[model samples]
Target: MSTDLSLFGVVNAGSSSLKFAIYEAESCLLSGQVEGIGVRPGSKARDAAGQPIPAPDVTRQPPATPAEALLMLLPWLRDRLGGRTVSALGHRVVHGGPQHARPERVTPALLEQLTVFESLAPLHQPHNLAPIRAVLERMPQLPQVACFDTAFHRSMPEVAQAFALPYAMTERGLRRYGFHGLSYEYIAGRLPELAPDIAAGRVIVAHLGNGASLCALQGGRSVATTMGFSALEGLPMGTRCGELDPAVVLFLLERGMSPAEIQDLLYRRSGMLGLSGLSSDFRDLLASPEPRARFALEVFVYRVARSVGSLAAALGGLDGLVFTAGVGENAAPVRAAVCEACRWLGVELDSEANAVHGPRISRPGSRAAAYVLPTDENLMIARHTRALVAT
Candidate 1:
């Protein structure tokens, strides 16, 4: 007989931070902590609600490595969980390449397979793999699962996933594979509970965080998404340049810059931080008087609005718009700008309602409903982990 596991742990390890959550069966039992493992200089911790949190006592230096961060967080999690034993662990892996479409139990072979896709998601994959390796060393017997961010977008049409590359290159895995799948999955799961009418129709979810992307959902499945091939293809983010001309990359290479240097410039030195030269945080940019900050904000909004229109077209019509993640849940101005840009698509933003943070932020008579639904990707991971283990 299979043992019934009751608790599961989910971890999302980013380039600089680790976000964790614990679930009892399929329900989230507690919101987890964010441990700044390898944060850049001048970064600060914020509560899950986006309020500032006191930083843990650590030497003031460059960000701690992912392993060091996980070492610190494990103890904290143990204390908060009161010695609770999670039967399984789920990880949010950023790239699954062409093969993975669902959660899989982590093994040496699987890890080796995943390593091949590391170049496809250089900024996140290594960091994501670090904690899993650490946990494996610590708990040799514990079952671990990997849930890919690209998995949910697997249902995207062939035309949407492909580029006009040669068959040989395409076969080698050059194609769109959207990120933020767990977040989109969680939102899709909650739709029946939140808005049955819209959930049954066409839906677009905007996952706006340090890394942002939009997904088009029809009948509760992904039809298309903004991020293509790499996370760097969609919306401009905290540090990454979203989309650029192929010729730009060639030009940079021709300037004697190595591929690694070009990658760093595109992934770490661009986006809001590069454009603003002040801050990557939307709140910080909003507070700044610099014209560059204003320009960055405009660029972000413009890309988001443009993507919304494109995704809507992919869905044929827009039924609902879901705003999620960090900025999507809290940044009123960003949402306002996006809604204004989408006004032609029947979005009517309720200013006062939006300011107050409504799950339903659209006017009653608006043709397309707008909402602010907080996403819990970790919870989704935990659920998938539990299900896979139970079977």
Candidate 2:
């Protein structure tokens, strides 16, 4: 019989932090985060019931790099297991490029292939692999699996994936690859239960966090998405300048900006931060009384509403809309504004329901139903890991 693995580890490595959770047969036994990596790093954890557990060692004790952080977290995890064995480690790889359409067992070859997509997702790809390598060295016998953020959208039709570039350029692998697939996958899986009435129709899942994107789902499959080619190409994020005209890069280059400078500018200096010239945190902007903060929020809402229109077109119609992730789930004002902008699309937001961040916030007569749903990408990763390792 296949090994009925009981423990699974899920790691989501971002540019600045790693969020990890330990699961025993699908129940989260422990969850925590190591934040400020490469800066003033720190770690904190909690039990499945949400009780505060001690940090790996103490607050700010985690390493300042992905490799070091993974090494540190491994020992802590082993200690917490109390003799329980971790059957495998599952990773949330932000990019799978064109080849990886599903979870793949981590190998030297797989890691190498994933590295090739690093430049395509400069912010996430490298960090995602660091832990995989660290685990390989720390416990070579342990299995590792990688679940891709781009995998779920691999089912997108050719027309949705194509970039309208020359066939030669397209063959060279420059094309749209929708991101946040794992989050969308989780939301899609739950939509039937959360909003059964509209789950079968065309739905748009807006994952609005520090990183934001909209996935157009028809009958539970991706028909189109706002993010294409890279995470930097969709809605304005915490620092990313989304959906820039190609000529904008040319303009910057002609102005004597180097490629590296352009990369930093678009990926770090733009978005709400650039617009406000103040802060990137939506909470900060909302708390501020400054007009610039209001402008930044306006720009964000405007673009989100605009993307919804485009994605709706891709699906040929709209039935329901979902808001998820950080800003989508917590920022009631932002949701209200986006719903306000989309009023023309027949979205009638229930002011009271939106305020509480409930699962459903739409009016009965609304042509488009609006919902606030939480995403669980780690759960998705753990599920994939257990299935893969069982084989």
Among these predicted structures, which one has the highest lDDT? 2
lDDT of 2 by residue, 236-323 (tens): 9999999999999999999999999999999999999999999989999999999999999999999999999999899888899999
- For each candidate, the alpha-carbon lDDT, in order, equals 0.84, 0.90
Clashes of 2: 1
lDDT tens per residue, model 1, 4-94:
3687778878776666666776566555444545554232344445555554344454436665665565555555556766788899899
Error of 1 at 195 (Å): 1.9
TM-score of each: 0.90, 0.97
Lowest summed lDDT window (length 10), candidate 1: 39-48
The true-versus-predicted C-alpha distance at residue 317 of model 1, in Å, is 1.9
Error of 2 at 380 (Å): 0.7
After TM-score superposition, the amount by which residue 262's alpha carbon in candidate 2 deviates from its true location, in angstroms, is 0.7
